[model samples]
Target: MDRLAGTSGFGGVYGAGIARPQRGSSIVIGYESALAFWRRSRVEDPALTRELLAQLYPDDMLATLDAEALAADTSLRPLELPNSPFERIHHAALALGLREPVDIVVGKDAARRRSPSARCHVWSGPVSDGLLVGVEPGVYICSPELIVAQLASELGLYKTISLAMELCGSYSLLVNGACEYGVPSSTSHSRISSVLRLSDSFRGIDVAKQAALYSIDGSASPRETVLAVMLSLPRRLGGWGCGKPLLNAEIMLSAAAARECSRSSLRADLLFDEADLDVEYQGREWHTKPEDRTSDEARQNALMMMGKSCLFISREQISDEARMDGIALLIRSRLGLRPYRRPLSTGMSLRRHQMMLDFGLA
Candidate 1:
């Protein structure tokens, strides 16, 4: 698994456990299911992905096809059990005592009826070169990039960027899929795709490519992602134009600072390295006890001693335009950048206001 993670060539399919296609393999999971697989993978076992991949792709396929060529070949993939992928999955779920809707993807030309069972969402399309990742022999899921690309048409710009952040963010959506009489289930999975793998010319990735350009890595939560996007985007689109900061970047502390703060290092929610400043997004997740405040003060004192400025922003301040602007002013002052004096255009003001409320903090 370490070797698998270490390899740069395999991409997210390997993370989801792509296997070589065999005689009766079916392409089962895709779309929301594929997205769900990635979010679930962060907590699930890499072994699951691995085993599924092994099941999908027969090892013997490599004997004739080179590794690269084998990965590129999607022709060996089979239809979903002679006819209906949706019904096939529904029956399997019933056997397993599960009841969630199953999403199935098929090639653009694959034969599918008008509909399937009540619990299926069918998507037919021409998948990109690296889209399908086999987990069980012939079974596949859309890659993370492909999933985002699929979503781009629906998500627009800001939402697409937010999706990118969430996909690569610290917290997983964490679905507990266990259901039924006595079937045992647990949570787990792996990281198989990233924004870096986004393609410019991919069929459905036109908007996602732009989102990827603004997307940064290592966001801890949705709030942090909102802050990053809000502060990093250009002013014309309702942002402070603070430029992208390092989200959840670790900063090693000096012995003196560590001694005072009682820690050797600190992980800032957002860090502007050039300005020697750190912005902390103190959302509802943080405990508000007196001791927590005391500890936070100590850390702040440590940063002050180190000659680094730290600004704390809460959800309340984030929602208030005046308060957020004050914070931005303070940040720009510290960054040695000029603040905007001219008022935003009416359209820009509306866009900015909408952006603040757009992110689903809940």
Candidate 2:
């Protein structure tokens, strides 16, 4: 495993990219104004310092983080924050200190490949057999899987993949209380996590057929259908939407709705409580919250509307008549769309639930 470039706020290495000050450079020291306040508190934690700065500034203070201090601080370690998903599994391994066989490979082939020298597969993609991290052998604060999940959530998407492979040492780095040689006793063939499916249905198809397949009533998830429709088009054509096809079409549709909401001067209090919120959209004082309804009904309506719109856009270029024909066509196409409603019948709900109490959702 090779050492990656820089790691200031991510992974383990912190200060690799900072530039040193020259001897002739002017050094501005305002000890009376700046040092006096810091000395009164003398805080060491980066997150605490960031919190204080955000509190004091209350406006664009995120740029003030000192990468130099962040890297050199011994008390701090990689992925220490609760908000991050990276677990302290390596720390547990290091504590074990067993000399295990470490095998690193590039792709799925290398991951699944069986060889005498192999112990782990350094798969470059987001899929992780157990825990995944950097290609380098040293301490990593975050894994690629965690990073990908964060990116997907921020982008309001479900999944994303990478091409680069990292160090995938075979065997769990920790065995019981010590680092053992070769694969960890716990790692077994039964521990396989992800599997790929291949089929002939993914072959060449024209726009109409592609649209028809995706438009078939309730056969797949709205996001799935949208992604299928997007992938069916050429790269250039697909570029019109978000970069990742796995992202829900709602991201685009919601943006349009947001624009409409903004134009209509909606109000925050009408939709959500504004007690602790620090930000609000401009000219949004005229909006009306949707009437309270059963969750199932609301979800069904949303899915129907989203699916209908996505299929309409996918099948042909948008038209005024297409909008008007929705009701009549919906009745006639009820049978075709029957498959899409199966998930609802199974009693599964799509709304996301917050995991921890600290996130504020609880």
Candidate 3:
């Protein structure tokens, strides 16, 4: 009798003392059961499947199957399944042009059966349909709102807020009656607010709610989101406590003026309308090109010609805590606000410190 094939894409057969099939076609039992088992286990990526099996199973058992020969034979493989929630979110974030790291929530049943690993985290809490997005058959992921909630539960307040800001600042809302990927609308703030209200009973909902206040839509990058949060967070929590600033605030230009300035419009990364202060984050990755640098200089000059004060924060400046403090002090001094008190030392909480590192504040 022919032995049953294993469920992995790295084709192989299983069972003890089972003879290889004769010249005729093989009779495979449990084919449907094996497929269902793989799908339920979230073993979607073939490459990841190989890695997991190698890590989890005994070498002698693996050696029994001709993994290399099976890998070369495509017909023996299982059907390719949709990615796990972790991978789905990562791809979704990339599709939506977000740069923040994606966090995931593993169901309790799956977590209980498998050993913890870095590939995905175990979510030891309740889950419901409202929190998930079913993208394909047997594939599930957290919706954007639930993603924020999971981050809040796992990463704490500051990092969660920072991630929420990144999401709102970079991506538009996912509403119906639009394209498959959805249209770019300025509904991130409102959508997040609604999510907070709906998820009020979820774990870590309080922190998620508080974090929503600091998030603004229309941010262009992760760094820009962090910069906005740093400036707007209250000083009591070691932030600059500056009033909320508009992100990517537009400066309109007439055709003639635009032609003369060599641009159509100016969108300040962070704009304080009351103080007329424009804070820009210039990362080396995007600003290293000579043309990019020249264009930036010209844009700054144009803003200056319009009587706007501009502050350019480089990657270096923001990476250093002392330099960021100085920048905050300069802004406060210019706005005629009270003297900048040295940002209170981040309290002696290990979790807070980890959060700071995660959000790149450290």
Q: Is candidate 1 or candidate 2 better by TM-score?
A: 1
Q: Judged by TM-score relative to the true structure, which candidate is superior, 2 or 3?
A: 3
TM-score, prediction 1: 0.75
After superposing all C-alphas onto the true structure, candidate 1 shows an RMSD in angstroms of: 6.9
Stretches off by above 4 angstroms in model 1 are 1-6, 9-18, 22-25, 44-84, 91-100, 118-130, 174-204, 285-287
lDDT of 1: 0.60
Candidate 2: residue 150 Cα off by (Å): 22
The worst-scoring run of ten residues by lDDT in candidate 1 lies at: 179-188
Candidate 3: stretches off by over 4 Å: 1-132, 137-140, 171-187, 254-260, 285-288, 334-336, 341-356
Per-residue alpha-carbon lDDT of candidate 3 for residues 1-362, written as tens digits (9 for 90 to 100): 12233332222211112122211121111111111222222222434322322222122332343433323322212222223334444454454333334223333334322212113344433232222223333333433444566567666677777656544543322222121111122125554555465434556778878777767767766677677777777765546767688988998655654664698888888888777778989887766588877777777777766767778898788767678778888887767778754536546234434545776667
CA-lDDT, candidates in order = 0.60, 0.22, 0.51
Q: Which tens-of-lDDT digit does each residue in 23-79 have in candidate 1?
A: 354645556666666565544555554443332222222222333343344443433
What is the TM-score (0 to 1) of candidate 3? Answer: 0.57
lDDT of 2 by residue, 1-362 (tens): 11122322322222232222222211111111112222221122334322222211111111232333223321222212122112222332333231222222223342243333223332232222112222112322122212222232222221111100000111111223232222211111111111111111211212212222222111112222232322222222321111112212122224444343233222221011111111111122212333322322333334334342212221222112234134223322432322222222111212111111111122
Residue 307 in model 3: lDDT: 68
Task: Assess the local accuracy of residue 68 in candidate 2 as a C-alpha lDDT between 0 and 100.
Answer: 39
